[model samples]
Target: MPAHLSYDVVIVGGGHNGLVAAAYLARAGRSVLVLERLGNTGGAAVSARPFEGVDARLSRYSYLVSLLPRKIVRELGLRFAVRKRTVSSYTPLGDGGLLVGEGRTRASLAVLTGGEREYAAWRDFYGMTRRAAERIFPILTEPLLTRDELRAHLDDATAWRTLFEEPIGVAVEERFRHDLVRGVVLTDALIGTFADAHDPSLVQNRCFLYHVIGGGTGDWDVPVGGMGALTDALADTARSAGAEIVTGHEATRVDTDGATAEVAFRTPGGPAVDPTDGTVTARHVLVNASPQALADLLGEERPPAAEGAQLKVNMLLRRLPRLRDASVDPREAFAGTFHVAEGYEQLATAYQEAAAGRLPTAPPSEIYCHSLTDPSILGPDLAGSGHHTLTLFGLHTPARLFAEDNDAVRARLLAATLDQLDQRLAEPIADCLALDAHGRPCVEARTPLDLERDLRLPGGHIFHRDLAFPYATEETGRWGVETAHANVLLCGAGAVRGGGVSGVPGHNAAMAVLGR
Candidate 1:
């Protein structure tokens, strides 16, 4: 063992959240050290050029920015840039598609539903959610509120009952009569959560709340230079604040005594060659790993099972696929999220199939053209050549489906998912795919198991674990990031009000350490 190094605070996992916490603590003149297992930081929020001889940068795992709090962005003075999509989403139906955007939503819905009733319902339903978002989003930055306190803060019994008390499926079903419209509303509930829309456990409700209330606006924007830009900005902010960052260092164990916490880590190469280990003792320890990872580090029993239920696919396309509906331009349809077989019944069927340990015959997925909104992701040569990038997020494909024969399962799932996507396109999507210098198509799919192996996410749970209600539970007056140990705190997506790229947990963890 080497000599014990000490710091005022030590953050495990150099994800955006950990970096955020380190920046805040270090800015306050507290000595801080950040340990990251990967060669670079960013965790899931990373952008990479996966294809050989390809200039397109893809946001590999987690894409889009919705849940990031603006308060943190402003306070940190980070230089991250995100571009808002002019089109929100475009879901294809029989011959036309349902288009949802900022200024043109009503007209588009009227055209899709072919009537004013469903359009009126859409307006009313979103109106309620907007009001709910206004009331709920502000509370996420504060200390955890009790259930009753949150309800009281909402101040509307109907809004509370619809959003908090009942399953979100109930609200979706009651509000919309059209299956496609209903599915559009329910997709938010099922994004990273592996629960039925009607799950009585209200897991879907919790997911829905985060999706809608992100940044106090339900807009999911694309980071200009790819997701890595956000993390890079965060890293620069932390370094500017005088925080020490050590990459390729994995925290093996965390021991907390009454007075302080100690973190043992293996540097760069494992213990085989580098037999000696390093230790950092700190007054406060902020963990950005999943709860399961934390439990393992603490040598405690595992927490509840966490399994991510989404398959991510990234592809570089030679050109945008032609839409079945020629009336709408391919650029317009692909600019926002393009839904493939994600209707209400279709999503439910896929969920049922996946739950039964079978891949959905027609996977419910959505695709977005990153280059359509921001051309900076591609090299000037590629952009001039009309090349584009597509990111597909397949829902209801849980981690369990890929448990055995991961490659075979991924192949089958990818084929089926692309087939479903092709159904909506005028030409086969594969035909539009670009080729790398090695003559292989520029495409990659990541299953939950792959995510676990690559990103060290337990069971590939994206939010670290299932997202909890932003407010407090029975743990009274406790900060959301507080763990059972006094010196140790969860500053990752597993913490309360934690999830997405918000960095709320990191902020809260630093506040806890500051005794605020």
Candidate 2:
């Protein structure tokens, strides 16, 4: 609700990406305005005390950070930081397990496989990906690189063949022999994607690359003070740079004629703008929403809807659950990704079962503790009492499986998923749950359908759509943010190199506008 009708740029969706664009554009002296439909900014990257009177702030959605660039943090001088977990992951296998960090990774792998071959193979495979990350992560911020250009720049024919030319399953099969090890490696490819190991379409490969290339080390870091800390910092930076961000205003439609455009929005309770009623005009329209939402806003034909394939559960634990694998401490296992029934065969079976329109009999998931790395999210009272937060991410639970009856399917799947986790625990996780002020358990489960209802994510697809390779396609304009309209750009996770918590698309959109 600004009286001014014309502005330099009008951004839709005040998510993290939109805040990045707003901060960059405003710092460059552009009159920028951001419209958000939610009551607060940060979109999915916010932290909330979801449990009543819990005295703990949990990252409600999109927890953890791996892809966010340090360049953005430095450029904006945002007061946000991340803490690294000492352990990378722990995969329970009967009485033994595989722990991948803290100088015991090789020994743990040896125990799991009964040999050192798997450990060597793991080292070699990750070494290749580490190099690829170093070379490929830089391209995300620059202009779009064509497929051939990127392949040649990588300079590793083997890495290209393993990652780009063939399915990730091929590489997983060729590089690793153990079923549990293979599943551990392949889980990254299926985080938010609904694809098989050998899906010829190679969506899993793109997802895998994004996951491994984060921070040039593939290590997912915990955002200090929760994920909302980063978005809050970005919002503060944008505001200080003179960008006006208006929450509770939804951009309904956009009418543009290439050079200049008018953005129409719905304001629940605010005075209208001048000269054009509820419309605001700008030289460029940068949409920080999904691609499907952009097409709808532009009144164009919508693309195929994307389906999300993950189940998220957030829980507050009075104490960490005891593990059946006594060789590893519960603290060490929960500190990193705790693999639950995610063996390679189990994952394949789950994917096939879900593809055939049923929930996986043995659901595959991974759990990690957020408060283990940063106890500050819990106040003095909660932290002093040994309280912790656990986030469980279930795989292969696609949106279609719950289309018939979301609540019923969610309940069934939640029970099955927790059962799988309990198999590896000495005691039930439910027994370790903390109670909120209402005397209810401090645990909540969200299916893909629930995400759509809450976040406006089309079909609950977290990336907004299937992630594309970080290369130029036929539709990829100069910066990979451009649309058919010269003045329109995508600044959200829907952009070509966009996904996860990364702000590449937003930075690229601003760069395109600056002609840099």
Index of the highest-TM-score prediction: 2
lDDT of 1 by residue, 1-516 (tens): 222399999899999899999998988999999999889999999999999999988888878998788888999999988889999899998778898887777887888778788988888888888888888887677778888888888888877888888998888888888899999888999888888888988988989989988767778899999999999999999999989998878899999984698889987665577544688899888899999988998999999878988889999999998888876788988899898898999889988998999999889998898898889989999999999999999999889988889999999999999998888888998899999999999999999999899988888888878888877776623778887888888899988888898888888898888887
RMSD of each: 1.7, 2.0
- What is candidate 2's lDDT per residue for 84-181, written digit by digit as tens? 99999999988888899979889988888889999999999999999999999877899888999998999999999988989999999998999999
The weakest ten consecutive residues by lDDT in model 2 span: 268-277
Show model 2 residue runs off by greater than 4 Å. Answer: 270-277
Candidate 1 differs from the real structure by a C-alpha RMSD in angstroms, to one decimal, of 1.7
Question: lDDT of model 2 at residue 133?
Answer: 98
Sequence-dependent TM-score of model 1: 0.97
